[model samples]
Target chain A: MADTMISEQVLAPIVENRAVAPDHVELIISSAVLSQAEPGQFAHILTPGMLRRPVSFSRIDQENGQVGLMFQIVGDGTRWLAERRHGEVLDILGPLGHGFAAPDPTKPWCLVGGGVGVPPLYAAAARYLHRSRPDVIIGARTADWVLMAQDFKDLGLDVTVATDDGTAGHAGTVMGPLETWLQDHPDGQVFACGPTPMLAAVSAACEGRATAYVALEQRMGCGIGACLACVVKAHGKEHAEYRRVCTEGPVFAAKELIW
Target chain B: MVIDVSVSLPRGLTLKNPVIAASGTFGFGPEYSRYVDIGALGGVSVKGVSPEPWLGNPTPRVWETPLGLLNSIGLQNPGMDVFLQEDLPFLRDQNAVVIVNIIGHTVDEYAQVAARMNHEPGVAALEVNISCPNIKEGGMSFGQDPDQAYAVMKAVRQVTDLPVMVKLSPNVTYPGLIAQAVEAAGADMISAINTLVGLAIDIKHRRPALGGVTGGLSGPAIKPVALRVVYEVAQSVNIPIIGMGGIATATDVLEFLLAGAQAVMVGTVTFQYPKRMNEIIEALPQVLHEYGFASVRDAVGQALPGRAPIRGGGQ
Candidate 1:
């Protein structure tokens, strides 16, 4: 059998693993491969029992080839992974899921994220910060759910925050603050990542406003496309045809996306 | 390293290993080739398709239990146009035998699909899956009724010079009757025990696990039923047998071989582990070596001690 994934066991030290904002936990896996991965991308991390967990590529060390993955423990697989030691080799399949696209050098950019979705924004933000930092807004359920606030601040991007409980930053989903900012910064392109509901909300918010790309989520079976298991209706399609979440995208344009 | 193990049907079709990726489980076979070589398989039975396109059953079409999975995919596939235009080119590149499995509502529909497939260059055989209940008349009924099974096979036999393998439903009360009917009508081979009729109650969801209400159950759970069915069908028919229900390992492949299957098909396993077919193919030869057989032909019915060869027993 042809091994499509060139795999190697890696010992990723948990640089940080804690409830950043309640149930969500951001893990900066210490590895050289992380650096080679781009910002809008992700890693297919093999959890202890979960088989393979696709986490957002929050950040990467391109020169060192290391990357970071962040996720919320939603099921038994995540629970099993959470019980690992700080220094451990978590067998993983990586750089999975289409990450956010890099901004055109001449064009302005905007980034919007929700809760767990915020992690994918870091890599995108880091890339553009070299010349010009993009405007960024992240939403969370409550003040406590706003993770990686300090990390975003460190990236030197024009960052804004929104929380439903109003415990921190502007209170509400990222859309309220993001819409206000985008209306003023009309020229900037948009990139977003979040749960389906959150992405849907943002997609609606960005309607007819900005060209936005969304990282869609579905209950994936084989994070590779073979199974045709995780398929969703493609937008504007007559047949109600489906697209594979793992391959064609865990990412798509908010406008091109059907659901 | 796992040993190379594969099986081919009695007709001498070359399979990489005996572990075939089942129809409906491995979509068109090309998609899985990216992760693992689909060509290195005993073969890949493409998802069941009809003359016209099938929208298939509604969602909640699949659910996982403790160790098994229930599915009512109803064989959702792009019609023959898509198959020939989009899938065939890619499938031709794959090394495995491409067994184009056709499904239909009426006898004529089956003829039409087989006719199209018969002319296709890369396809090695046409597997007529009569187990699907989604069709109008000749689907599950064609499998359960001896007369209907013979009629469908006769129509297909008349249309194509290509080899035809009739896949039987495990839901039948008399699988042997259906086997005999197809054999009499000139089926080249038989793939025994399609998903047995099964249902699961979603206690938490407070309804059935599938939107189809009743779905086919497959996995490790159904292997025994499939084995028993293969055993019975093998003794009853002289046509070569392709046995598959819930095959996962090489040893499991042997169980079907001994039960009278000339070759074994693997379904449901790839759904759980995408490269599981790889594991079986890689280790199958070692499995054979362990069994002290020079070639798979010797191992075919070795599992069925005294299950004598009969008229119309094999392809």
Candidate 2:
């Protein structure tokens, strides 16, 4: 099946570029594609290199036709993205993959994000604005690495920060505080995105208590389903079924993941 | 005056244009139709089909090289049953020729898939995938050995009435031998070369970049190698050839045609720009006009060294 909008690939101009974290830069691209993007959807950004780099959305503004991309300077691709000035056009094939299913409003929602993974959760948190504020837990290496804490607080969500080196809020991984938070709100659902290890721990913690949807990151080829480059194994009823993270989902139920 | 761009193979199959979407790059079908008119291209070679659904390689299946791409997709597909039931119906509606690229681990598996295709309505040809480098069995193994390639091609040729084209791998030392063997085994056409076996290391991680250890290399890096093989096989065989490797533009297509390929297949490039194949198809007429050829068919093997190479004539 065709997994993406064929005409959604756009050449959007960068309207804003600023450092949101020590190693991360936030890009505000003016594109109509933003209006169609849901929480956890990503864009295949063409850099000054061979393949397009997939980056998830950190924020979306429909009225202004702009979407935010927060990327760390991991390799040549992200470094190229960080260097671009305003008005430069970026070839983005996006708003792709099945995004997060909206959480039930009656039940409380808990959002867990680690390091660069914190961005996509912002958009997910925004969905809870008029209903009820969701509790957000963010993990980083240090105070300088922690991102968008104030932004989540601005949205009226309770923000808990965890740093490995203890330069900020809680002096450990976000899992510790997240576990305690889950205990207080037993009926809450959890949505998370972060390092594989962090996500795995969260998935393990939320096992039978609450349903969790985890956004995965993988090296991708065609941001569409045509290429099977971004496949991950499913642990559902079928023992060894492969699912494309770029097409079927970037966000999948934690129970479905084989990892 | 309108130029005749259509290409008719020595086999009964004929394509609307000389540009076909290579297998593995284009999905089952309908994946690219939303972006471009699928009927505009000469043909669409659907992804490699197997007897059963393949899960494919692990994560990190693709990596980007300079102007090339390395992938170990492992021929992930929905299998013959689902393909015949779900995928083929949509391809039947397209205006282009459909070349089903069939893959199997054994000779019997290959023949079974081919026999099943004989009942399918839309398929114009069967591209026997004996040269894929990603999968552990049956692909490159059959392609590298002339005897194995002959056996597989002969088996499928006997089971199906469709034109059988053996897709050869470049990993072997003597591709001409393999091509000759397949031709003798009733292969109506040849597609050379498949991706070259390659590996890329991540020095920091101290491991291979691809999860499958080594992958098949494609893109501009393999273009010259593909052209040389096509030139060599064109002179040594009686059947037509489909040349492909790192083909990106109309000039590349012209080069393949002049090097003795009757038609060309475009892959890897489709990933970087989804609609690029359409651009190349549209530009072919202008390109053929520049070279003083009235039709794309007229340009085939024009650059060969022989004053008069055999047309349908035997070598």
Candidate 3:
């Protein structure tokens, strides 16, 4: 937690840049500056362009001083980051924003991630050592889009996959299997990250029966809170107010979100 | 040797230095505290505030262009009531010069905001925002027309005792004429040039990239245009000029100052690095010294055509 102070850190030469799935790549860089990163915290990766691209930390390996960031090649900036070679240094501002809370060790934990959202959950699963293993549910558009299934399996946690086209695990949104899992483990708490609609569905699946947390995505200007570009409608104690996703949260409890 | 970098405007507004954080970039003041010291800046021109709370434009309000950025935030800001209650007090605590940027759809609306601000104790000055390119009827509409610009400045002047600096748009062909009008109408100082109107296409989607369709372009890309306006307007008006548009480094600051600006405002670069203004402020003394000047005033208008050479250096 102490190392979370914002600093311009260097990315150690890329030791690995492998394709994770279609249009997605997993980048591994060594950096001691990001050691305090807990689950759900993201880094603002600087590009040669004007705005810094915010990418969540998929894995924070404190022992080896390595941090893993997975991103899809959606735009020019991401494509630029994907083209970097070994030993090329990148500027990053992070260990930013509030991360997900540490769930109770005695109770079951359910982590629901959709598509690119699947990566951030891996770090949380590895960090949370508990009596019961966590249920990792991933949703993708098709069989070709499913990622990190083997990585979660290697961690020895219970893994579930749901593909929209019926080419993978549950043949629908991950909510179907997630709802079924909730019925059995009714005492579990859920944590989800994905597109807004998926998060809305996950929040609905909890339905006052369980507590849930969700991470939101917004177009950001200054990765710091100054620009007020990445604001979300959040319910405060008195009224609805704008909360910064970069500072207040990228991860917020489902009940507090206006959506 | 310590160099005195302070600057003084006509209305007794004295800044510790010449570098100011431009409006619409630095939020009321607390957001950038984590990275830089707010007190270190000469002044903070806050986001444009209207008479009422504005919800702003839809999603995808910002886009990146080569060496520049296009943003149509539509002057989104909490109204004056919230600003006075919440933002102003925080800025006062920082002890930096607080210049409030105000906008309106009509002349009365602009006057009402200034009148309200006139009663506020901590506000050091009023930057009449007649130049924002994003809004529909009031922004550039008031700026591009000299008659409307004079009327707006005159109305705002009648309401406020505090110093009023009219921020002008670069979109005008004869910004000099507009500067002269505002000066004659009762403007204490002038700030030029606001972002130039621009647009970008997604290409793949075959649609405009910005949600607002068009946005105000800023950054190093518009620095030349900013210099041109500052140079032209400075010769036309006697009031102090606060130059802005695409300013980033200490060298850029020096360029604006030499081009006949009393002070310079930094906008777009703040988005890239929140603490960049501090970096520019810190390096100014050395940069000024390298140009063989002891104070900021010594360099003002050094690049103007008719300026005489200094005793120690040839122009």
Candidate 4:
């Protein structure tokens, strides 16, 4: 049934834009439709002359019905998007892929993030904070690479920061802190979004002890399921038995995902 | 007051707008809804459905080549059974007309899928996909042989009285003949053209760019050829035509209309921008009005060059 009508004016302008880290920037948009989008969701914002690039919704302004898209200048699309002015219209198509999932409000949890993967965690942090502030751990190569430290702290949760360069809190990667926390806090569920290496490390560090969910990013087309361009492997299933990040999830339980 | 520039599609279906999401590009419809409401389009052509589930070709199914890309997805779809059980119910919930694209190896197989599809709850039309030759013994593509295409079309026509749109492949030598054959076999409309058969070899891998040795080239490159095919067929037939090929902008949509296509479908562009169909639809009226036409239908193939082309007011 084609012909579901909508008001024109999508791809609206972002009213505010600012840098959160040296390489990371945030664009606050007038996208009420996108803001209310679930925590595990992401957007595929159009870049100049390149394929639309998917970015995670870092945070939301529920009162103003706006969304915060956080990203680093990873490629041509992002670098160009970074050069855009505050009021310029961005041909955005989101919230595109799946987002993070929250656990039972009563259940304690561990929140972990790596690199550009930190944004969606903030959204999950916001959701979890209202319920029960989960213990958070962030892993980055150096203190300069860590993102949104204050935002998570402002959420009033117990936070653990680790950097490979040992410039900040701990003297090792967040995986080291995460390992210690899982041993000490065994009952807590884990919600993690980060680099695959970090996710793999955290998944291994907490294996068989507690249930964990990890967010995945894949090269996508259509940001819908049409292209069949994006897929990740699964355990105990045929190589044919794959799931779409756009449709099924960008987030999956640790066991359901193979990598 | 917006005058609802949509058409009834002449296939017993009403379009909220004139922009239909082309097949093999929009997936099963429910997936893109999170970003843009797909139900807002004129219609949705679900991914290519087959008699059996297909795993599709290997990775590197696509490669972005400038404004467009090359894809050899090979119609990856959960068999019609799975689609009916797993995908259809969700589609029905969207409250938009769902057009199931049927691909089969033989005439009987085409008829079988079309007949079975006709019984589905939300299915509004049957679009016979005969161009998907990348797979084995599937799709009505044998119909590219004129008589073969006619056999498949006639077989499906016998079983299902629902409106059937024959999607013609550009690879066929004489698309106009195939169009005429389908029309004679009782096709209500025609959608041309499917991607042009092509290949891009990766020098490093020492193999073809697409996992499948060849891919169907869609996007701006084939649009002119698509327009010509539509223009020729429009003058040659009495049935309405659905023109498509690398349609991304309003001007592209207008060109299809001026070439005598009653409607237009936007495909590959959805990958880059899923909501592009909406933009084209929103931009269409202005494109039409800009040329001083009161309605979009007036712009249909009206821009044909003065070659004293064939006439078909046989209605």
Candidate 5:
């Protein structure tokens, strides 16, 4: 109840809305209040439906007072969001949930992301650029489906891409490069955001050898932690307890997850 | 002119306004405090408290239907000990009227929670929840059976002197029969209706969308059914009725009042707009004036059968 981090609900005007990839739209909204958002935290966007869609902050520009949201058209909600035009206002509740913690300065770090999960890593990479460049690994179904590889590269971070069809830079899942990275930097920390299977793989690879922080996704309602709708199973005393993916995480240390 | 929205329920439980945040959705008062003024709300029916901390169901507990939401949260709470030690103190600090919604797997458990809340400071009333559809045992089972419902209410009534409002379920064949049974068992008031049991399939996975397989349906889609249940229960019981289910606007609140609900609980809509209850409370006076009703109490039972002719400017 006594929230140390303040989150705001605002009707932010859409400054820019365009397709960044196939069926993926990068929506930028003008909200000086939300520009203060941290990486891995999400914005609960009001769609043309009863429920709000929780989208991660793909890009945060504090100087311009804009927060960018990227999402694919998965259903009526995301499809409706993709159809929104520039200048239209979106009801957004945001900068919510605990974001990825800043990595240790002296230690080496790498980022791993998959599909839509790649966006928050881009925000993380943007923050990491302040200290030194961190390695980034992105995975997608094909070369065309790969998202934000160039975004990370433009940030001057060493980037590696993997696709299921062998059409992109290291074919197969992100595990190949992740395994190699873990072998080389045994003490390196990993920050990841992706599908559950890939995260479980990354968690397995980093176990006992390295540390990993993963950003998770789930179907959510009232992204402000009021509704206990979006919960993820985690190790708890006596038994596994359901933790709020919207609050206790969207970002959790990979070691803490049950999966 | 100012409209008197204050509602006086049985056992000295009086609300400054007619809008109470329903259980489960509001999350014990503090969750929405940043977006809403907790003290300004009529009352907050905290999520169902059992004797022990419940972990609830697995993932994918909620699904979005057209104009509605389906949830199978399974009443996850920190139990009576945590409620008194952690949650109730925060609400007390806010000076908010608290309505503890008690749930149990057995009649004894329900009475145990009721007994625990018996003289707890800052608690205005106890909302006995025997209508939740997510649990495997008790909950909706008690509400669906009149005799079982009567037994649960009677047990809680014996332990607590606070105004007890039994939340009714629409999934039953005759909600009024259950209402009358609880009334006879000494329930001071009734809140109709709890969410309707529903299902949504994830076509891609060819499995149920929610982890619970089925969940309680709530939102704008359930409003009409809730209104119907409120209208029916009003005639069956002499105690005041609190109508809730899909109330999103001041007009919706007034509709419940006309159908014999003394006050209304706002649930699913608050998930969409965190500050919605405050907005509805702010808009009620103008809406009441527009309808030629002097106050919230004046509009009660206006639409009930055999009542005097509708006397309102809008009509």
Candidate 6:
């Protein structure tokens, strides 16, 4: 099963690196090998530290051979990545992991993202744009924390904003907007990427109402699945088994997840 | 002149080079096949496989430290059946020198895996991993005690005529005692040292960073300790030693060889650069020449006390 997904390790030069939002940097790197990356897949980037930081593809430009990665500076690794300048070469291994499966054209779809998780959903929205306009709900802690709402709007996606502080669109968590979307479109398919609690909430809301898919984040090593570092609980025939997030999925159907 | 890097262990196990992919770091084989030529490696000590499918640990199995990686993956594997059916054929096809690293929760379980792998056509050797720090039972426990370590090696030796290398744990007070015990119990060779037990705190969560709490630390942080263990164990036992712990370059490999290791396994460094082992192998000859060594064999045990004087003035 592992024979099919072939990934390349390339040295990509940063084409553009800038702060896209508060405490968030968007890094666009030019690599012919990684430019073929799909939505929801990620690049395992080498940092100054020991381990590689796994960042999802925020934007994939197949035509120009560029892939953009947007990440919040939560740790030393991301901080090092943020410090990289345009023209600086970064060692990148990608387009890794099983990405979000293409939505059925006949079904309505909604792309829900929270904070740093918004980037991959943006990539998903871009991929699904040719088929149909998906409803995109962008959520964050506050107005300053919200990301890529305008970019979704630029893509002509039906965008909704939610913040915990009520400093932006809808008040409360993304659950408010997500619940309303599920109620309005019972048959809609939901695709989300966010913190564990947010993803759990999204998965619970979609239960028996819509088919949901989620992208998971975990501390990883050897992003190629050799180290067995990034695994998530999965339902099995007898009991719960661990699945490699770097291989079986960074994206999985909500039903397959134990959470 | 071509530098000879080949290694020959007891029971007819021969490697074309001294750089092997350590167990747990490299999965069965296919995980890094996309980036690495499987046949080009000296050998691959595949992830530890038990008799039955093991569930391993819960979420947050790994944490990064300064120049090290802490992992409590708990030896999760698809078991011997899945390995023979799914993983082995791929390695066999690649013509890889396959060293099956076997582990179990009990002495019987260890014997069970050994007996099953005894007849495998493409297997080059069996690396008995009694030193995995992650598992709750039968891992570090077996390697920490001399009697238990002797029993496990003896049981494995009884089950298979295959070349058996018992992996030693560095967490023990005296790793050389366990090494000597295994050698006495009929171990063909030894691989030292397993990851050192370490911990990381998730200050944000106010708890352990890894799900398994304490994890085995590997990478550059543990190299000095590994070198110390290999140097100590080399003085205690006559069996060939396969040394591993944060080996990243050809220079590191030479350090292991000079410290009395017959071969070396590259683990966590592969996580940083998947092609590192191959690169190390390619660079070994020039590195050996620069260090004034005629061959990898000549370099072994040069740093040991009372060994012959440093040759070629390359130190």
Per-residue lDDT of B132-249 in model 1, one digit per residue for the tens? 7544456787898899999999999999887789999988787988999998998988987788677778777698766678777778888889988888887788778888987888
> Please, what are the lDDT tens digits per residue for candidate 6 over residues B1-315?
778888777877888899899999999888798888879999999999999999899869889899998999999999999999999999999999999999999999999999999988999899999999998888999999999999999999999989999999999999999999999999988899999999999999999999999999999999999999999988888888999999999999999999999899999988889999999999998999899898888899899999652222101
- In the order shown, the chain A TM-scores of the predictions are 0.87, 0.96, 0.95, 0.91, 0.97, 0.97
Q: What tens digits encode model 6's per-residue C-alpha lDDT throughout A27-116?
A: 999988787777888999999778999999999898998989999999999998999999999998998998887787888899999999
| Per-prediction DockQ | 0.22, 0.70, 0.48, 0.29, 0.79, 0.85
Give model 4 RMSD, 1 decimal: 5.4
| Model 1: DockQ score | 0.22
The regions of model 5 sitting more than 4 angstroms off are A1-3, B308-315
**Candidate 4 docking class:** acceptable
Docking class of 3: acceptable
In candidate 2, which residue pairs get closer than 3 Å at backbone N, Cα or C atoms, i.e. clash? B219-B246
Clashes of each: 39, 1, 1, 16, 0, 0
List residue ranges in candidate 3 displaced over 4 A. Answer: A1-19, A63-65, A85-87, A104-108, A129-132, A164-167, A182-188, A204-211, A234-241, A255-259, B1-4, B203-206, B307-315
Please tell me which model should have the higher TM-score, number 1 or number 5: 5
Error of 5 at A90 (Å): 1.2
Superior candidate under lDDT, 2 versus 4: 2
TM-score of chain B of 5: 0.97
* Winner on lDDT (1 vs 4): 4
List TM-score per model, in order.
Answer: 0.84, 0.96, 0.89, 0.77, 0.97, 0.97
Off by over 4 Å in 6: A1-6, B308-315
Candidate that scores best on DockQ:
6
Residue A162 displacement in candidate 2 (angstroms):
1.4
* Clashing residue pairs found in predicted model 5: none
